[model samples]
Target: MKKMFAVTALVSAFSFSNVAMADEDIGCGLGTMVFDGKSGKVHKVLAATTNGTSGNQTFGITFGTLGCDGTGTITSSQKLAMFIDGNMDNLARDIAKGEGETLATLSEVWGIQDADKIAFNAVAQENFATIFASENVTSTEVLVNLNDLIAQNEALASYRI
Candidate 1:
């Protein structure tokens, strides 16, 4: 019984840690909006469960209801950061090349219009060294650097997160 309890506790700890480290927010939904300012394990769990069980989160994301933006698209920087984190290698390569599927997808994620894609790609390729400053550069650092680069460019300024 003691061994079983220990194992369960270990699993629970891992689960909680993963959730705590999640890049995205609880998400836009009725439950999330209702519990927005509340902080605590219990409130978080309740909000998450309510969003998941009621399926309101999906509904909100799709229809842009509740606190969700009406674009039916990824409107959160956290989600964009998560995407960059997951695709760092591909993004680095794409950015370095000035054009690729990953880079194009990232532009889309940033809501960059087709007219500005050339400028966006050009800026990314030109500032590859700055964006990926070091071999150990992290996703957050990459995002910051990329945003800074975008801000410096008049054509790409509006796309800066």
Candidate 2:
């Protein structure tokens, strides 16, 4: 009787172990999108794709800024332009350590180890577009999250926005 209870408890514990080990969904900013009006209100933010492709479209958000245009809205395009927001070398080091120090990690991380180390890649069309879009210029204070960037890295499973 006591032995039966112990066996059932052990089995139940094992059954629940896998669920406990499930990976947490890490939110990383791939990079920021900035719409510099050249005269009107400027906007910027970290971006995410709907279906993980340009065909899928995108969405974005600024962390600290407040305003109607503060959120960066993404658009579909064959190609985009952007600039590196952080030190690439530093971004690589964090990824090698299985960590991220910056707001955006995809470029810096992938630049160091490729898709094997992270979840996304610059080579893939979907990732490439995102990276390109992130590099787009905007007003100061716009930043990217390393985790968001790494979420798209190929080593990890692709994510839904």
Candidate 3:
């Protein structure tokens, strides 16, 4: 199960995530239509299709673009949450080690800004056990817990996305 999730995360990262760059600007900012504007079923389908072609879609999503413009499937935050859940063990290990592919991949998946990244990683490294303490934790739960951790700490507040 764990391996399966890890594989899934890798697949998602390679196929859907625009990890190479850190910029927040994305195509037409249309992804925002899903959450901020009027996004009916038709709009959602159009956005998803546009997002597919737009390599930077996830960037807009993580920064509150809601890439797909739909409640169906998963949102960018949900995808990041699941990626973290699936890779928590490796993440903890990498955080403990201070560097690894796991950490790098997660950085991209979470879309942690370059400016806020070190602090965020440090927080994750410090709170690894608390953040990933349970195998039964859902993606949403992980998100809340992580955001809460960021909220409580001044230095990590930049991670709240």
For residues 18-112, write the lDDT of model 1, one tens digit per residue: 12221133555555655767887687767767666656667655655545544645455766787788799999999999999999998888888
lDDT of 3 by residue, 1-161 (tens): 99879845644544464433211222233343333344466665565455556443554445433333222466667677767756866866887766688887877777777887777778877886677668656545666777788879887665565
lDDT of candidate 3?
Answer: 0.60
What is the full ranking by TM-score, best candidate first?
1, 3, 2
Off by over 4 Å in 2: 1-125, 138-149, 152-161
Per-prediction backbone clash count: 0, 19, 0
What are the Cα lDDT values of the candidates?
0.75, 0.31, 0.60
Backbone clash tally for model 3?
0
Rate residue 72 of model 3 by lDDT: 46
Q: Is candidate 2 or candidate 3 better by lDDT?
A: 3
lDDT of 1 at 110: 82
Over 4 Å off in model 1, which ranges?
Answer: 1-75
TM-score, per-candidate, Cα-based: 0.57, 0.20, 0.46
lDDT of 1: 0.75
Candidate 3 Cα deviation (angstroms), residue 96: 2.8
Q: Which lDDT tens digits does candidate 2 get at residues 19-86?
A: 21111111122212122221222222222222123321222113211111224454211001122233
Worst 10 residues of 1 by lDDT: 14-23
